[model samples]
Target: MSKIESIFKSCLEPKEVYKGGKNIPASNKKLYKLSSNENPLGASPKAVAAIKKAAENIDLYPDQTDIRLREALVQDFDGQLAADQFICGNSGSELIDMLLRAFINENDEVIYSNPCFLPYSVFSRWYGAKLIDIPLTNPNYHLDTEGILNAITDKTKIIFLTSPNNPTGTYIPRSVLDDFLSRIPKNVIVVFDEVYRHFADAEDYITALPYVKAGHNIIAINSFSKTYGLAGQRIGYCYTTSTIANYIRQIHKPFLLPITSIEAAIGALNDKGFVEETVKTVKEGRAYLSSEFDKLGITYWPTQGNFFIVDPPLPEIEFANKLMEQGIMVRPVSQFGAPGKVRITVGNQEANHALIQALEKIKPD
Candidate 1:
């Protein structure tokens, strides 16, 4: 066996995958899938058209530079940022891996919130960094910023902060973020994963871009997957100072993004109407879900993202299994460090209705 294989021996294992509403097996009737937080309204017509047009160009390699897509992003953001500030990847996961490789050195410390996105810790471990986790406060599931700052030492190289955090929809308030940044050592690189930024409602919510502009050692990672309904296309980008962006590009594999994905992303960026429609639909569905949960007497977090976390009356794994038996597939939070809680994605009105109906049946009266 190779050294790499030996290193990964214990980590290599297949896990069960669940899709919220994909448990119906294969009946002719369509299943309402609320499992993954995919946009149920589907991709924008403009993006579809762009993909179709780009299909003719499959014979050629994509522009390694991805200039047109970067330009569109620059224009969409009103020229506040330049193309040089962006680095496109196959998905947000790939971007995460790239950042880990670019910044982390052997045994360097990487700090992130527990019950957060598992990939941040996974990548940190893969790159030989010490993964430091700060658990959230109970009940509210808010980040422990002071604990995070106190955990930092000279070996700390990267800190991952996710707003509207995964598994739990709670977000770090802007004031909290400002205070945390002020206390952390300047040498540590911070990654603000704002993949769910569009769903936030707090008036004080702000992207870390301003901090980057102010010359802080930070990177803002965003994805078209959640809001743009392009998760299948696997497109995401990171914005940072030109210096860090150049470093990431140097370490990134050339031509990793295909032509079709680039065109699709560009098309999605231009489809402001579709983006607005998605946001509206999600907001409405989220409100509807909240109301339904309230009426059902089930407890859930107040979400600012496409998904919400609920502490069901039953054990989370058992509750999820029961829902799956009824052809509903919600994600259990055990791996995300919150046992007895399940994370559910908000879908279209019909899908949300289906989920509510399923819960009503399985939940205690």
Candidate 2:
């Protein structure tokens, strides 16, 4: 065996790299991608302008502190959260890794919903931490609060909760969250990811940011990607207690997000009008897709997120391939442990129509 291979034989097991919805490479066909849950409206106009303006200064490094982004976030929170409580990262995924690095010790336990966020398991195992995955409750595919509570042990260090959880598109209600938080063990910290918050329209859906302000042992991470249409910019921030924020700051890479990204985020924040329009478009698209699924007799969970998990009328892979053949792209969720299921991101009016048309053609009668 080679020296490097021998040295790392027992380390870093092989795992499938995450592949969100992507465009097919052929230059000829017109493609409508509803695979990745990217904002179909694209980036905010103001943000695009800001990036153009900042392009001239690409040679210089960004402000490592990210004071402007943090300050904007604080104002956006309406004074409920202070700037000191924020920790910016390349994306919410990076923040997850930082948490694993800063907190998880050998054999330490981490808990999260099964088939929720894939990276939670990946990062936990990378840190040599024990991962306890609790399956979502049936019928709604919501968080299994009791199962999570029961699974907790002395070694448990973190519990990851993704609001309007990915793939499943279900969210934990406020009452459930309150109960879960009250009973959570003192040794554990809950990491709440609210990347899709803006798309959630359910009345009972509550953000965990308030808990952070109340000084709970929770960190709420949000991104400009979904709501602000800045996914390509790779900007996300978290709200936590000052103590945890300090630790995250220590571990967060220096100048992690570039100046251009920060400027774009700042501009996105300024364009509240654009944010509202994007949310409205997504809400309408979600309704349209859900109604179409119902008419087609596809079994799908009600979603507060901008995506839907549907049991396609055919085998998952075959169904996804059919969609791709029609020049439409979507996610097959078998890798997320849900065989025979696929997740579709709500796109713009035209893309939504294209997706529905594609499904109608392929779905078994």
Candidate 3:
């Protein structure tokens, strides 16, 4: 065997990488991509302008402290959080890895949801942590906090809770969250993923940032990609206690963030008008899609996020294939453990209308 292979035969790394939605290439016609849940209105004008301006300074390294981005984030929250409480990453996925690196040890137990954020399982196992996946209740797919609490043991180290959870598009209500937090064991750290926060419109929807401000052992992950339409620039961050933030800082090399990316994020935060418009656009698209689905007799869970899951009239593969044939793209949810259904992102008026037309054509006779 090769030296590297022999030295790491027992490593927890998987041979296959994550497989999710993608934008299909080589179509002769125009494509309305509803695959990845990217911002439909496009990147914020301010962020785009920032990227252009910062591109001139590409030779310089990023500010290791990321003070500007963190400061903007603090102001974004109306100064409820200190800049020290923030830790930046290439994306929220990296923050998850940082948590695993800082805390998870071999045989240490980690709890997350089934149909969970796909990365939760990958990162947990990569750190040699024991997996305790709690299944969200069927149909609605809401978090079963009691089931999660019941699964806790002395070995448990982390629990990931994705509000406005992807693929499923549901959230833990405020009452449920309050009760769960009160009963959570002191030893277990909670990872609250909220990258889709800006798109959530349900009345009961709330951010877990308040808990972080109160010094709870929670890390709330969010991103510029979803809200500001800078997905290609790749910026993400989290809110946590200052102590945890410092530990992450120790293990993380801050210079890895690109200078252009930092400037773009800061610019995005300044454009409150753009964020408001993006939210308004997504809200309208989601309502249009939901109404169309109802008319077509489709079965779908009510969603608080920018996307929703749909049980199409045809088989998963066949249905997805048909959609593609009509110059549209969507993701199959079988990989998320929600087989026989597909997750669709809310698009702009033009894209949403195209998708409904395609669905209407593919509907059963």
Candidate 4:
């Protein structure tokens, strides 16, 4: 047998995987990239300075335990959680994978929303878990809590909840989440991916931290990649009760988070002004994009995240290609099970204006 066939016969083809964005080649001219929902403001000055200062220590391995960063996060969360409650990872995606491996057994069922983050399904399948996908509600793209609850079975081991869900930008309301949690069996672990929590504007939307604090089987995941503009730094963390947190840490490889990333995150945490400024920019950009969509007669869901999903009149793939020709990049949601929808990252004022201008030229009257 060929080497590939002998090593892993059950593996699927690479083409079957849904990659996030098209890679744009570097050119002499700068490109305004809005394909990924990254912080347009870039890293905080404090974080940048910290990273530079930490460069001299590159010869040494990162603090194997990442205690200082964990302490900083504890302080940042305002003592809502203890230091032992957190586990740092290379990125939010890595933390997601760790949580899956740590909690899920082979062939166990994993439940999540359709048109949610694509990785949840991919990672669950990687661990040989049966995937249960629930479709979002019509028009609003909100989670179907009742449907999700009904899909649960004794075999179910995990439920992935993404507030301000990817591509859809819809959040689970507090009442809906509470009801869902109450209905779920205690044996199953619920992961609340709050990577975009900083952008949420609604008062009634809840973070899963409270559930974790109450000693529920819930883990709250957050990333510096979005709000803190530390996407390139590759640092994210999870917060849960000490019991589950310790279990996750046991499986996590030591020193996964680099010393530089840890220091940068610490500095970023201290720069509250920068975080507030990023929120303001994203909020303003979201509002502007929404108003423009209204004027263009395009359907879109109001979002509390750094991005919004738009139902362009054309097929999403074709729309995205057309936008690309105009030097604009947007996320096509076909892979996430919403083929007609396009998820546009809210950019700075200039990038937003460019996107609107390009849309005006191609959008059907």
Give per-residue CA lDDT, model 1, range 1-365, as digits (tens).
Answer: 78777656342233322222244367664566666677868898888899999999899998877667778889988998889888888888889989998988888999988788878877777767887988888879888988898999999999999887887988888899888888888889999999988888888888887887877889998898888888889999988888888878888776888888999999899899998998899999999999999999889999888998898989888898788776677777777778778888898888899899889889977
Backbone clashes, each candidate: 2, 0, 0, 0
lDDT of 3 by residue, 1-365 (tens): 78887766253655424675785698578998898999999999999999999999998877877788889999998998899999888888888898899999889999988786788887778888888989899878989988999999999999999889988999988889888888988767999999998888778787888787777888899888888998898889998999878877888775868998899999999999999999999999888989999998989988888888988889989999899999889898877768898888898999999999999999997
Question: What TM-score does structure 4 among the candidates reach?
Answer: 0.96
Count: clashes, candidate 2: 0
Write down the TM-score of every candidate. Answer: 0.93, 0.96, 0.97, 0.96
Alpha-carbon RMSD, candidate 1: 2.7
lDDT by candidate, in order shown: 0.84, 0.86, 0.87, 0.87
Q: What is the lDDT of residue 219 in candidate 2?
A: 93
Worst 10 residues of 2 by lDDT: 9-18
lDDT per residue as tens, model 2, 1-365: 78777767342667645555566576688887778788889999999999999999999988877778999988888888888899888888888888888899889999988777788887788888887989887767878899999999999999999888988988889999999999998769999988999988888899988788787899987888888888888888888999889877877677778989999999999999998999899899988988998898988988888889988888888998999899888899877757778998899999999998898898886
For model 4 the local lDDT of residue 322 reads 86
The true-structure Cα RMSD of candidate 3 reads 1.4
Worst 10 residues of 3 by lDDT: 9-18
Tens digit per residue, CA lDDT, model 4, 19-114: 867666576544567888999798899999999989989999988786788899999999999999998888898899899888777789999988
Off by over 4 Å in 2: 9-11
lDDT of 4 at 275: 98
Model 4 Cα shift for residue 346 (angstroms): 0.5
